[model samples]
Target: MGKKRLKHRSLFLLGGQPGSGKTSLRSAIAEETQGNVIVIDNDTFKQQHPNFDELVKLYEKDVVKHITPYSNRMTEALINRLSDQGYNLVIEGTGRTTDVPIQTATMLQSKGYETKMYVMAVPKIESYLGTIERYETMYADDPMTARATSKQAHDIVVKNLPTNLETLHKTGLFSDIRLYDRKGTKLYSSIETPAISPKPTLERELNRKVLGKEIQPTLQRIEGKMVQNQHQGTPEFQAIHQKLESLQLPPPPSSNTPKIPGL
Candidate 1:
């Protein structure tokens, strides 16, 4: 008898801003797959370091620059090894740039693997707050093991996310692409009727969240409440709160936003 092919040899690409809950969603997907998937999260590699705690304390945000290259090489090697064996794979990233992801997707597609992408559609204000809260919880539980997201890096990813998402979709390398929220709720799915495209839907939702008249007032209220809270009394959070208060989110691209070529 001839060897049978496995349809489950799939690759899932998970990308979002740093605090957009990619890790949580990855965990959920892994659980649903019952550990049948190989996860390639760069942060997972960073956290695996023996001196991760000490490094975070010593270098703070610069910790990533010092150690990420080694872990990144390891991740690349794993992708190569696992894809050869036809294992279902899940890769997580901030989608800060379109190059690596597009390249990875193209590589996997050439291997006769079905590639799928899931992007988190989270508001920047909410995601920025999420980063602070995540650090606070992790640092409180175990200072040595806690890893903090760089504010500068987080902001960069936040700024570039829309463009990155659009670029990936336009590439047409993945068979499917989905947009999800922090709570694991599916906000938009590309496989739905093609009449409803991802770009316009993503643009509208993101704009509605931050470009409205209520945004500034809402931010002020959050900042005032944060000031009253004991945990949020720290100077770091105060600076972030102020930044969010003054943040000027871009409006929907309207005429400038490109349509998804064939969509």
Candidate 2:
């Protein structure tokens, strides 16, 4: 039997402090990989807000909290669309502001693709505090007008703060902050890909095991009938063979493929 050839594309999420050389490294990787590395940053969608200034501050103040969830959905859609178009994605963002990376990793892992986390860092330790200070004086006069920029700054803080998030977990100023960061050197992303143990839908489990990972094990009855007629000339077999050929499944030993034991 021919081995199952799996063409797997992985997504690596580069997350870290602003001063961290994430952008430079991401750019270098993308250039080296040519079209394979796709970096999606917030700057792409942020311009869409008509009153971007107000939105930025509101985002920082935690006033428009629901926007975070919507952003995650929008990102997922963008990643999905990009994957379908054949470019492997590298999602880069200030994770402090939202749960987009967790959501994306969960979604991609479920679909059988691999996802990884990257932690980039730079030498600046107190930059975030200074950033918050700048936002305070810069937007002091206009409560409603300074939101968009505030939100952007807030995102940077949320993702890059010196305070430990897991230990701080929602203490006063931090309610919906990121879960954790700060374990070790670069590439030590706390983010983990959960086990891909799909709930037993007797049908799917059975199909996957028998059809050998690539073919629909459940469709063995159909696949067997199709392969049996791949060479023998007949319209019904020809149609079946055509359908099977398009799927490009591996040739099997028998029409009635054996079932995987556990499924």
Candidate 3:
């Protein structure tokens, strides 16, 4: 396959406490900047993982990862699309964001677009609790929200396991398998589903370094809260709101347009 040329956008990252009303601020900023903006949140695309609440009812349910929309693919796609369009961005997500921000900064900087962070420094325990609260409310309204929340929370669990084990015994390929070696110590791997056996030598090594799942989600929740605009009625907020209102979107192209004659 041939390599495709990538386009970039200047994103203004807005991360803080979960349920901090980041969406409200995003709306305000979009209105203010008069530049196109959209969230990379769960609503960006549809996710399929039915019955997460039922699954969570089982033992060991951690909830943040279950609902977050900032998956690896979605993140990369948003960055690439933004780069191409060169539009102003106001991203909203939980705190423990991965290399996307740094990578995006370096990339846009090279292209002459500036980037800034609005980090919310707060307590981790408080942040984690906030995420749970947001999802509980979100799931009540959106089915997709429920599934994403379950997936994110499971991600937290997989990241919080021991790394020193030389070997992991597997009675089955996925979660149904028994994971302890004869020593009786439990093993941890990303294969929550029965897709792959955790007993593979290389796979075991990869899973070990990932222990520490709770940290990022906790950070995200706090980040979400701090960045919220409680007073959208403020002058600055209203300015942005008005600018957004002034934008004139183009109509969709007509279906009668002719296609190329040759393939």
Q: For this target, which candidate reaches the highest TM-score against the unseen true structure?
A: 1
Cα lDDT of model 3 by residue, 182-242, tens digit: 1223343334534443325323432333222433444344334323524244332343333
In model 1, residue pairs whose N, Cα or C atoms come closer than 3 Å (at least 3 residues apart or on different chains), thus clashing, are 53-144
lDDT of 2 at 228: 41
- Where does the lowest 10-residue lDDT sum fall in candidate 2? 197-206
Question: Where does the lowest 10-residue lDDT sum fall in candidate 3?
Answer: 164-173
- For all candidates, what are the clash counts? 1, 11, 38
For residues 1-263, what per-residue lDDT tens digits would candidate 1 score against the true structure?
Answer: 12223566778888787777787677656665666787777767876777777887898756777778868887998899778877888898878898988899889888878888888877776666566566666666655555677668787886777777777777777777788776778787767744345666555554445553434454455455445444465655455454453365543344323221111
Candidates ranked, most accurate by lDDT first: 1, 2, 3
| Residue 212 displacement (Å), model 3 | 32
Candidate models: Cα lDDT each: 0.69, 0.43, 0.40
Sorting all predicted structures by TM-score, with the top scorer first, yields 1, 2, 3
Lowest-lDDT window of 10 residues in candidate 1?
Answer: 254-263
lDDT of 3: 0.40
Q: Higher TM-score: candidate 2 or 3? A: 2
